[model samples]
Target: MNVRFEKLYEETKAAVMRYVSAHCYSITDIDDLFQDTYLAVYKSMQSLTEPIQSSEAYVIGVAKKVLARHYSAVRRLRAQIDVSLDRRSGRGLAEETADSVDVEKLAGDRELLDEIFELVTVMPVTVQRAFYMHYVLEMSFAEVGNELDLSEAAVRQRVARALTEIRRLYKRREQL
Candidate 1:
């Protein structure tokens, strides 16, 4: 700590703390942010091309930058977490649609399960792969997409369509 720079830091530290406290909503982040702001200020202070007129004002600028970076990172992490959750939950689209179909019937009737499996085998190749990977193998839509070289949306659509087709076929059989 240069004696001149140390003097300036002492003068501005309180004002910088207040500025950081004012901008931040979370108490847990405040101390860490306060530390980061001063670390930046110290680095800037080291590169003294010319003396700053108002050291307090200069430190406040550094604190603002730190706060901006913190919030930007927090936003990015939040978005990634949201996207991950949406993708996983979206994988259940077929299951939700299948819920409309009577799975309990298949559970009690082995012959009906066999018939449904046959119907699934005769479905379009894309639909069959999507349905089998997702339902039979219990794979997530994203995993099915990777296995079938399709997008997650495409995989979800195929599985859903397969379920719809099976329902139609099962109803036709019931009528007969």
Candidate 2:
């Protein structure tokens, strides 16, 4: 209801919607992400220390957080389902060979992966997709770039920047 918020929304909503839509996998997710993005932006606006320099960037940042949260939840749910299915199917030779795995190490790795996923969502939309397609989806830079309408060099740059940012965030967390 704030006048400033209305102005910010009017200025940035399309950009925010585009950012969310680009990252989402399905039409249903697009609507959910778009609405959640605004909700996050509204909540974040209340905690601002000063007037934002770029409303579009601020809204995009909030959208990134919202998207991160959504992905984390989905990953957790998927993992849970996998575990349950594995239990139902019983242990195969490969699964049985995992008995030597250290629970603590697995836990630590999961935590690190979650942190990396969080950092990925902090990047710009293009960079995020570039990183996801190139790494997670195992697409080559040229393929990813072609799909995204970017040059191969541009895709490489975005993926590199995304990794650098993730490493920076990881190091920052380590120091904390």
Against the hidden reference, what TM-scores do the models get?
0.42, 0.44
**Tens digit per residue, CA lDDT, model 1, 1-176:** 57877898789876665555445534335578889987887887778788889888888888888888888976647634222333223233332233355556556766667666656555555676566556645678997687667899988888777777666545544444
Pairs that collide in candidate 1 are none
Lowest lDDT block of 10, candidate 2:
88-97
Counting clashing residue pairs in each candidate, in order, gives 0, 0
TM-score of model 1 relative to the true fold? 0.42
* Cα lDDT of model 2 by residue, 77-125, tens digit: 7634222233223212222222333445445666667766655554465
- Compared with the true structure, all predictions reach lDDT values of 0.65, 0.65
> C-alpha displacement of 96 in model 1, angstroms?
46
